[model samples]
Target: MNLHETTVVLVAAKTATLAFGSALTYLSYSAFRRTDSRALRALTIGIALLTLGVLLGGVLHQFADITLEASVSVQSVFTAVGFAVMTYSLFVDIIDEPDRTRSGARTGD
Candidate 1:
């Protein structure tokens, strides 16, 4: 199809994918909260940040006349920060002593 049409299709696909990812992450966050998993809370935040960033960029592009380069830069920051949060969270463990049972040991998660 035409360039404009192709761009629209691509953007729609990207938004759908991001939305789906965000939904999954939010579900994970809820699950983590149920068990009060401290280490994994940061993972939820990271996912949220990335999701919001992607959505913000998409909305801006579709509605506003902002430059493409500026939009990319703005969204990149969110993605970077999200990854950084996830890295820090995963690197730091909160368990002082491992809780185990006779059955398969659970992660307390």
Candidate 2:
């Protein structure tokens, strides 16, 4: 196939990917509400941000005024923020679990 056709195919694939990502983000948010877990809240934020990053990275570079490098940089930053949030969520959960386990045992659980 031609390069343009290939690019179109790739863009289609990305659109599908973003749609799936958005669904996951929605699921995370729903899970957060039911559980009220801080970790799940952070995870929801992370997924939302990461999906936004992916959207920006895919679309912003198409404009003539925006440089590809600048779009990539912004995308990288957003993705990094998402990952940082998720890492904090994981750490918070990890720290709480052991403490809860120990406390429960001591409290005669």
Best by TM-score: 2
Residues forming the 10-long window of minimal summed lDDT in candidate 1? 94-103
Worst lDDT run of 10 residues, candidate 2, spans: 100-109
Give candidate 2's root-mean-square deviation (CA, Å): 3.3
Model 1, stretches more than 4 Å misplaced?
A: 94-109
- Residue-by-residue lDDT tens digits, candidate 2, 1-109: 9999997997897688689879999999999999999999999898888889878987888764578688778879999999999888877776877656533456544
Where is model 2 more than 4 Å wrong at Cα?
Answer: 96-98, 101-109
TM-score against native, each model: 0.75, 0.77
Among residues 3 or more apart in sequence or in different chains, the pairs in candidate 1 whose N, CA or C atoms overlap within 3 Å are none
| Model number with the top lDDT | 2
